[model samples]
Target: MKQMYIPVNTSLSFLLISLFATIMPAQAQSAASAKASAATSTSTSTPTSTAKPSLTVTATQVGSGQMATKLVANGSVAAWQEATIGSQSSGLRITELMVNVGDVVKRGQVLASFDSEAVRADLAQAKAALAEAEATALDSIANADRARGLQASGAISKQQIGQYLTAEQTAKARVAAAKASLDVQQLRLKYTQVVAPDAGVISARMATVGAVLGNGAELFRMIRQGRLEWRAEVTSADLSKLTAGMTATVMAPNGEQTQGKVRMVAPTVDVTNRAGLVYVDLILPKDKTAAAFKPGMFARGEFLLGSSQAITIPQQAVVVRDGFSYVFKLNPDQRVTQVKIQTGRRMQVNGSEQIEVLSGINAGTQIAASGVGFLNDGDLVKLVAPSAAVGAAPAAPAAKK
Candidate 1:
């Protein structure tokens, strides 16, 4: 059935209010852990305005080098020995036009001057038929010396002294055909003057003061001496690393550079751009007053294709990420390790931009330059200026010899 019982001072006042609600939540969690350990020892003895973030970066020290390797292409600059200058005599006209297209001629100078008034009236009708064939060859040697002195005094009659010595050999063959027609009318009047057969600079000047040209036509092209050349076109499998003399540079189109040599390599190979032609030469720099080195411009060459022994760096000290290639380095306490590299031949000498390091990285290390995309691995940098962090033009160090 059922049973009920109570008492003992109301179960000792509900067991002292459940042990004073579990000892007042463990004495209010031990007085809130002694006021959070006295506010962490009063913030470890105060004093702090906040600092710690530093990191400028830019190191260097790459080591083990030599790098020079080149190949590049694309080119132009021409006229290393042009020299057309024509007019072997034909019509005429162009009367006067002494030289222009940047002048500088020499060899036989006298650039143009035709219209010899009909070759000076055919050189005055060939000096009036060479003075009427020297007065009929001096009256046929004075009638063959008076018909051999009147045919030995027989009063000239050995068939009239062989007809006066065959009429003095037909008047000395018509005075040697009128002195060869007055030396061909004085050589068509000096081919109507239009000289400059070399020593050049005038790259072109199609006769104009009247222009009547014809035979051999042309008129003036020059450059035979104002030298300059640079063809380049390569690729026929690098045209066997070019020959003739090796050494090149080019680049001009305003960015100026020059310095060339390899004077010829072509030997066919353009079957629709399979590429070939080399021809370098360009040298110019004898300070032609800072001569704006010209000639069909377009340059870009390189060639050099030599040199070796390398390790190189800088090129924003690597760092590519997903596609690989990286290079923080910089330890000695400044932190930042990263590394990973492998690159190979990516030149730009005298102006910097190097990069070779073929394989994980070793030589002198020390990396990081130009804000390596905000660095990471172990961080903690601050190298400061070190010459504005290595880049005011830092590419020369990699080889320097």
Candidate 2:
């Protein structure tokens, strides 16, 4: 009955409202279903976040131990005592040279020979003069005896007897002078040979064949007794720690190692450098010629000052980064915290190299013994028992049956 009076515009409006209501409900349901599907897919595809251990490692505790203490020094290898060999005779030519540089020689060993022809001729002349003087002395003695007999018989004047006695005295003086000249000539002859003053290894040679040398001219230089010493320069404060008879180890530039004993400590320190010299005599090896140590070689040495208590850890536990040393300390939660440390002397303990921890972590602190280089600060690590870690080495595949 109302439809009989309803306008066309009103009917269209009703129709649009009904259609909007139906479509809105359908779209809302579709959106809800899409949201539910998305939630289910996300719940199934997402992963749960769980932290994993970065590395599996072993732990060690810092312990107090005795480490050998040493004072290090830098210096040179030198001859214990150097002897300069020279020519004692003058105006002579070197006829022969028996030894060269690096030659081992003994005391009184003839190193060079000089021309002795002139000396021999002079010696012969001296001998002839001595013979002539002896003959003249005998004649003078006979005359003196005859004059004494004549004086007793009063057959000769007093002045004449005095003259005979004076003549006898003069002749005796000439004979003595001639004998002294012969002895002088013999000494000159002996000097013709240049001999070693002491047993040593020759270090330098200046004598050449046919080269005339003057008195006191150097011919060869040698290290007396073939001995070598390491002269280490140490700070004055540490010099007192070194004493004679202390053991020292010297390392040559060529990585050759030799043991030495402290010979002496310099009484005075250098004013400019405030350092003193510690002379250690090296115990040369059996084959001296083949020895790598030589004079004037720069070397480094360490003086053993005995053992002292120190906090130490295995060398592998320490890590060096950016020129600074560090160690990873383990926390109660099995996490590693990087700790910078000061390291000192390295020593062998129980056949393992241990490094002295001067400061940083204290004794009883646990640290990552190995695999530290691969770890970072505040990293979680898994720990295995000592026996388990040893057995963890990759086992070989079983042999074929």
Candidate 3:
């Protein structure tokens, strides 16, 4: 630093200038140091955070209730008892077809007829032969009596009388044989017409007028006693729960419901499918106003397997994937956790279109109803209870007997 002298009058101004220069540089250096410290603090103390997907959710409560396992297996309706009307003898031409398909017939009612002209002729011949044999037997008896009288009078030898007696006995035996032949011929003539064995509707007609039939040729298909059956095949797992006399309802292909009781359970299971056939004898409505129920129609059914207490959730709460069902449950930490569930029967709730769960959910579990349709296994969702959906169909109340 150089020692410089200045005039006394300008000393204050020069001193002021010097002080400004010193203060300005010190202030600039202090500001730069403050900025460097701030930068270092920001780089070292920053926090890490994850962004979560936002979603709306609803909650529900699960409780104990009846669990019904409904099985929807396809099957057909068949006549509980049926007969294939057929003839017994061969070489007969049908002369009349009295009844037709859908006709209700009674037992022993004539269904069809065959030409009996030949049988009638044979029967007449047998009657004539029987009459001739009877006449011959009468003549032989007279000869035998004469032979006995001659033996008593000693006019003919004993050997000659014995020969006449033998001849009479042989003619008597021939008469008996002829009578039996005539009886058989009459019986055959009666077989020319076919009759119903029981009361039922005719399902089919195979024979017609001028058609020749062989032995045991089927003519008509009759449902014996107007009875029908619903044959439903169920899986092996469910077969054990079914029993005789259990109530069952069948929905036919034409949307007709038939009420019946379980009749028989097949002992042998189908090897391929491991299922058994369940026969349900239908109780047809006797009111003529009811529609006519026929056999061989495919049907669906529900069998009441008895009721038990179980946990159930709403069907809307369940999420199905790859043939399995799952539901999202809220943990204690307000996070979602996936849980696998086993569902039982599906039932209508209070006449509303919403479905009620049969089983697998617990009581008081928070469930996401609407928004979980797009969520993944471990997604974080913001819970928001949704208002009941609009225009929802009312559920059906419990069925009353």
Candidate 4:
């Protein structure tokens, strides 16, 4: 057997070459892979570096302005005073109904009439009795005069003259009683006609023809003076803000607005609700049909509490998410940061609807005027000029091309 001897250096060199060959290809492939990954990363990150705007909006600045402060309250429309018309005479049958519900009536106007035949007959009988009593009184006067003249003579005994004088006095008393009865009967006859107590609109009628009513039976109900008042339920804290003369604007359910003056504030607050009533006298419109407010109708009112400096923003700028109100404030970087704001009174400023920012934002802070609802917190936004934000008139369709 022949033994083959090789050079150790040569064999080591060859093994090193083989290992280098394998490692070089792997390293080259690894480098190429790394370069491809880097390129992919760069391409993916380039779009994020130049972030696109989420929305295009016009910027508005919070402004300080004098806005009328108001205290809003809900209440019911009621009559200033309600009068009940009732029968003054008992056992009187209603013969005629002259008025019905919703009829405007004046004081002393006949609303209904009762059967007066029985009353007139009683009056006639009383008149006859009075006449009889008057005639008897005249006779008594003559007898008393005769008795006085005879008292000085013996033709009439002293005891007999005294009896004649006593008889005369009794006859005079009977005549006076008969006159009183006559007056009562006359009054009864007058009560046959039910009259209005005050000038007002009839709200309810309960009397029916041929129905007999007892004394003090209600026949009709009226709103005194046709005056409607709003009784606003205000919290105790706001009660003091209202005086007897402050102006209140009340809105009816039909969207009709009426001006009113505070008549009075309730003296005591309701213990259960911790609220007080403010009575406001409404000034009805000239046209009765235009005054849509009616008794018992629910209404809302605002008491102008005078003007106060407020920081306000356009109403459209505020976005409500979940249950909180937010406004997107433009940062120096042209990005929007969602700011939670406490809102107060909403009012019209310069023909635009604005809402008072009670807290959270300061005056002169730039915010997204519109399209805020579509934006999120920390979103990039492109702000256009106010004039540019509004679309142009479409260039008149380019003159029909």
Candidate 5:
């Protein structure tokens, strides 16, 4: 009905309005579809993730045992009691020697013999002089006896008797003097046999065959009683700890080990070296290692301080981080726990470096043997065979090209 008054412009306006109404339904449908698609995508889509990194490691178990705490030093093995056997008689030439170096001799055993020809000659001359004096004294004594017998009668004068008594006294004195000289020569002959002062091992021979030695000239040096000792030189501090009963081990140049006991601790320190000596007595029965070790051998010694139980591990298990020692211990969950430990003595057992753990770790614990330089606490690590790792961890699996 309104079209009776509608103009051409009004008709165009109506057409434009109808066209806009038709386009609105299509736009609403498109928006509803887009909203539904966005909801479905938000509810069912998968999330993106990143894989964590891990490390492979090699490890060793904690070692548990007793390690002897010891104080180490160097010293010399020597005779415990050295005796210098010397010539007691002067101007005597050695004729025969019955012993040499390294010979075991007994007390009062003959060691050498001196030439007794001079001694025998002196003794013979004294005996001849004594015989002459005895002959003169015999004639004088007979005259004295006749004089005494005549004194009871008138056989001789009193003055003659006195002269006979004086002659007899003089002749007896001469005989006494000759006899004394002969006895002195006989005593000299007895000293020709040189004998050992005590039972010992001969270490040195200064007297050669036919050696004319003076009185008190040394002929041999021996270890009295065949006893040996180790004179270990130690700092003043270490010397104080050694007592009379402490045990020690001495290793000779030939790698022979001998056992000894602390015999005495030196009271004074040496001025030059500022060190003191500890004398250790060696027990060398003929059946023991006594024959193997000799005097003047340079040996290293160890004084065992009383020992207690300790826990130890390979040196590689210990990691130095920020001036602290740490070890990675394997846990029940197949993970590792970083443990801070106190390190004690570092020793070698069969060419391997084994360290003592004082605290923060226990026996039977597993630790990373090596290659722990970059590991953090609570980090997951793969355990690899020790041999597989050249020096550290085994090479990782090659990635796909």
Candidate 6:
């Protein structure tokens, strides 16, 4: 009205502004509605979830209360009585080799023999010398008798008779010396033959047919009476635990087993090793099936230190993971949960099969018997019939009384 007439461009500008205002409100309203719809949809949408992992498992039921026994040991088998058979005399050549290593021999069995030509010659010479001395002694005795008769009859001087008697006495002494020499030679000749002093299995043979053995040269090694002893070296602390007459089991290097009895506990400890020796005597089996045990065979021995009751599990049930032992336990939800366990000595079940367990398990608890390699913690599993999952869970404490 002040301008009386608006410019054409100004009117156009005002129309455009009014059109923009209307369009902007509609667009704003549309955007607000879209936002409201999006909010409602988001609120009503279903949520996503992660699925539980399924695992293969076996179940073990809780073991019942049973007496637990401990059998722990580390030892070696040794001969109770070992003899190194050596030659008593020197410069004897072995002429015959009768027994070799591992030959079972009886007491007084001839093992070997040396060439006895020189010994026999010496013995013959001693015998001949003894005969000559005896003849001379007899002649002297006759002469002495004649001299004594002459002296008594006053046909010779007393001094001359005394001289004859002295000669006779010297001849008698020579005869005795020769006879003693013959006996000594015979005894020395007997030493040429080597014989088993006791019934035992031959452990070693150092003498050959042509080898010359010296005095104290070891020709054979034997254990007396076939009594194989396990010489187990134990620490001083273990020595006190081991007593004579205790029973033990021995394992040969070839996996043969035998029973033995504790015979001796050494009072003195070896200064170099700081260990004492325990002697266990093993009886050789008289039957053919048990003849595998041999002397000088490397072996291990076990002596029971003591006995205690504790939880145990089969050796097959324990799983070693990352250098640690674990056993998967089946929970009530039928899931395998890993539980750490400490293992102990393997013992025979009812004196039959061996089972080992130390801790982290109890009797009559549900545990995974096998398939532990495919399982992890919190894995879902289906428990088979006869759940092996021992100690599935502890009972609730009477609902807090």
How does residue 74 of candidate 2 score in lDDT?
A: 98
Task: List ranges where model 3 is wrong by over 4 Å.
Answer: 1-72, 145-158, 287-293, 311-343, 347-401
Which window of 10 residues has the lowest lDDT sum in candidate 2?
392-401
Candidate 4 vs 5: which has more lDDT? 4
Better model by TM-score: candidate 3 vs candidate 6: 6
- List, residue by residue over 163-244, the lDDT tens digit for candidate 3: 8899899889989999899988887787887889889889899888999989899999988888888899899998888889
For model 2, the superposed segments whose C-alpha errors exceed 4 Å read 1-59, 287-290, 330-335, 349-351, 378-401
Alpha-carbon lDDT, every model: 0.77, 0.89, 0.77, 0.89, 0.85, 0.76
RMSD per candidate (Å) reads: 15.9, 7.3, 10.2, 8.8, 9.4, 10.2
Residue-pair clashes per prediction, in order, are: 0, 0, 11, 0, 0, 26
lDDT of 2 by residue, 1-401 (tens): 67766787789999999999999999999999999999999888877434567777888999997899989999999999999988889999999999999999999999999999999999999999999999988998889889999998899999989988988998999999999999999999999988899999999998899998889999999999999999999998898899999999899887888899999999999999999999999986786432889999899989999999999999989999999999999998778899999999988777999999999999999998877887789877878776676645422322333
For residues 1-401, could you state the per-residue lDDT of candidate 6 as single tens digits? 65756687698999999999999999999999999999999877845323333544456564533443423355555566788888976898888989988788999899989989999999999999999999999999999999977886888888889989999999999999998999999988989888898898788888888998788899999877767677787887667888888888877766777787888888899999788888888866887414666545566677866666556666556779888888888776676778888776666676544355567777777787656666678766655443544444412212212
> Which regions in candidate 1 have their CA more than 4 angstroms from the true location?
1-95, 98-111, 127-131, 134-174, 195-221, 225-244, 256-260, 263-280, 283-292, 295-305, 312-314, 318-327, 330-335, 338-353, 356-401
Clashes by residue pair, model 5: none
Candidate 4 segments whose C-alpha is farther than 4 A from its true place: 1-60, 150-155, 287-291, 321-340, 366-401
Cα-based TM-score, every candidate: 0.42, 0.78, 0.62, 0.73, 0.61, 0.64
Q: lDDT tens digits, residues 271-361, model 5?
A: 9999999999987657546767888888898998976677989887778988999998876655678899999876678898888998998
Angstrom error of the Cα, residue 306, model 1: value is 0.8
Which model is ahead, 2 or 6, in terms of lDDT?
2
Please name the candidate that would achieve the greatest lDDT relative to the true structure.
2
lDDT for model 6, please: 0.76
Give the per-residue lDDT digits (tens) of candidate 1, residues 1-401.
Answer: 12334576679999999999999999999999999999999998786433232367667877666788888899687677776878888877786887788889788878787777777787788778778877877887788888888776797578867876787788778778877887887888887887787676897787788767688978778778888788979878879867888888877766768688896798888899799889988787777522756777677878887888998887866779899888888887776888887888877777978888888878886777756676768766667666765444322212213
